[model samples]
Target: MSEAFCLELYKDKVVVSYYAEKFHGRKTANGERFNMYDMTCAHKTLPFNTIIRVTNYANGKSVDVRVNDRGPFVAGREVDLSKGAAVKLDMIKTGTAKVKIHIVKMGANTKQSAVSAAKAQKIPITPSKGTAAKSQSAKKLVLKSGQLYDIQLGSFSDENNAREYAKKISRAKFKNVALQKSGGNTRVSVIKVDGKDVPSVVKQLEAKGFGNAFVKERKK
Candidate 1:
């Protein structure tokens, strides 16, 4: 894979819809002996030694896993967790849970590159000085007496493309469209519309060929 595929942060958290039970004793893609009891995961592209923290958004249970192998190459499937990891996250109870993956650290060589990339991006550790204005606008928090929801556009490497997509959607009569950047390479476009229209926007986006478009509450 190209270096662009090298991810510093979890691109997105996908709820686990399934797990591998039969592949218990097989060797992992990294040639490490696999044990279903170990808190390890299989990711298609993450460097073999990257460490990712998986938090179950449902219950807030979390476990750190070593990315020691690869598989689950199926489309739309993000990462495959070992039985132990799933158990720790209490995901087996629901058979699935929304997970947030954060790469706190990576392998030795990849670590240097990751650090350099982070320094170059200089991602905001704290809210930036200008964010006060945007925060105020968002928190001005008007209720349309209808609905409020958030839509995430696919992550992208090009900021301009992300901005353009946000602008295009903003012009589509949307009430709000915002862009958030993380680690320089990942830009996400979010669109919020009245709550009553959440399903309509989801259907429209799906019909318009946007993948992974889901409705989330616009406010906490």
Candidate 2:
């Protein structure tokens, strides 16, 4: 499999939904009879039988599920869980939830399955040579500098206030939001960004009512 394909599988900010009675007993993409009561899930490109831990971001409830089918089929949604798995995460009432996915083990069909699924979805199989070269150059530049940028959302003297604000930011669907504590201050910030992207990220936060957001640079 191409490096680009492998990297895409690990990208974050996954939103998931569940399917239950409607799909139960149907033949899945992997040729198995769907069982809504079983701990199985459908992913766009994960290989059949791959195991993953799905954690609900809001409540911290998590469940281990095996990939047995393909897709949530909707744009902006990543994985589709079985009713059983969704129940385990206490997300049945919401129908859809923001979650974190951690790969537990890769399945045997990793290469073949991912490639075929990507093709079906009309996604590029590999990056163009120029794109790949540019990406490598960018990585080298970051490594050499050992510097990173953050968009600070807020800083509070109280830890509880900082955590509550962080949760509020997360519920707004912002990516990479986190809380950091140092001394008596707790800061809520978005921790993933290139220096050049700081302005745009700050603009996004401002639009969502975080008008005090500012950029901070840190050396690794």
Candidate 3:
């Protein structure tokens, strides 16, 4: 899915507004044929054929349309709509309306346009408000104890070798060895530990060519 985007509002004049099918086959400002009946839309700089969702604030109704043509081209206007599109949102009579526009992803071109535009604008991509809370809760479990520790596991094919190595390590030994069998290989991992032991464990592991590892805290 394309990232959510904000509709940039122009100086209060229904800047990027819609036009309908009566202008079908008519020449758009950018020299493309305008087709009103198509579920398409227009924008000032958005590439043609880009699909956008137009939502009427007053009625809370929205219509998705493709950018088959170029724009309202009027000063301060950000988009232009076809007559049919305006009627669907019930904004035709006013000749202009306040609406929120968003891009809908149904294909690659629309996706690229939405992405390129979003990058150019430097918008922050954030999870939904509801999901954001869950993320914060998850992060809270990772405590900082102001100490360092070593965390590790063994993956040698021979069980004896794995045990001997574990015993040789000077740090306190954690016994849980999770042997995971994938295809013909068996891998071992140490999944739990005290927050204080993380740094020392990582340092030892790095000296042995086993790089730093992430810590996962147990949930109560």
Candidate 4:
């Protein structure tokens, strides 16, 4: 049997649909001047200046967006991503895409400054290459005991591809291979059981030629 699974979990995952249009040069609820080109988002409840990982289930794109505004009260829409974030998630043409937003950390200030000012304050607003792709692999991942973990290999535009990849993971000794669909994309993942660690699953994924595989909180 594998060891106790570990991962940082704040139990936060919000299904969101980004902005319907542009909102540049507006003052955010946090008193920060909004820049549509920045990697920021507007959340209704999360404290301002909180950093989050927004994964677009449509195209499998993920980006770190800071929460500096409040909105998306258009019923069913959770938060609104900036123009830059929408671009990163390939949501420009779609306008809104189904997304999973994970709370990463809080910002330095209760109400974070604008992206430009935040950068000037020496805060790291932009993520590195690895940090931006495949679920922020550049950032440190902490593993904790007793929580469930999943090795997500890929999100494809086709459900067949996702099923095929799940088959591969199953052949590699991983169990509970599953396919999840949302926002026009299908994802392949291996649900962990028997106390497996996230890194071990990641290694298995790498051995199976999925070096870009990333860990996500297993849905209960």
Q: Return the top candidate by TM-score.
A: 2
Candidate 4 lDDT by residue in tens digits, 55-173: 77777777888887755534346678888888898888877777665555666744433332222211122233322212432344344456676655556554554565567667777
Taking every candidate in turn, the Cα RMSD to the unseen true structure, in Å, is 13.7, 16.6, 21.6, 16.5
TM-score for model 2?
0.49
Candidate 4: minimum summed lDDT over ten consecutive residues — where? 2-11
Over 111-186, each residue of candidate 3 has an lDDT whose tens digit, in order, gives 4445445333211212332211111112422334542222333334334434443444323444444544445433
Off by over 4 Å in 3: 1-14, 20-22, 28-32, 106-116, 119-220
6-118, model 2: which lDDT tens digit per residue? 33234245688999998789877666899999999987446678877777888988788998876554546778899999999898889998886666666885544432333
TM-score of each candidate structure, all chains considered together: 0.46, 0.49, 0.43, 0.43
Q: Rank all candidate structures by their lDDT, best first, as comma-separated numbers.
A: 2, 4, 1, 3
Name the 10 consecutive residues with the lowest summed lDDT in model 1.
Answer: 129-138
CA displacement after TM-score superposition, residue 166 of candidate 3 (Å): 75
Which window of 10 residues has the lowest lDDT sum in candidate 3? 129-138
Error of 1 at 55 (Å): 0.8
Candidate 1, residues 20-55, lDDT tens digits: the string is: 567777666566777888878876445677777777
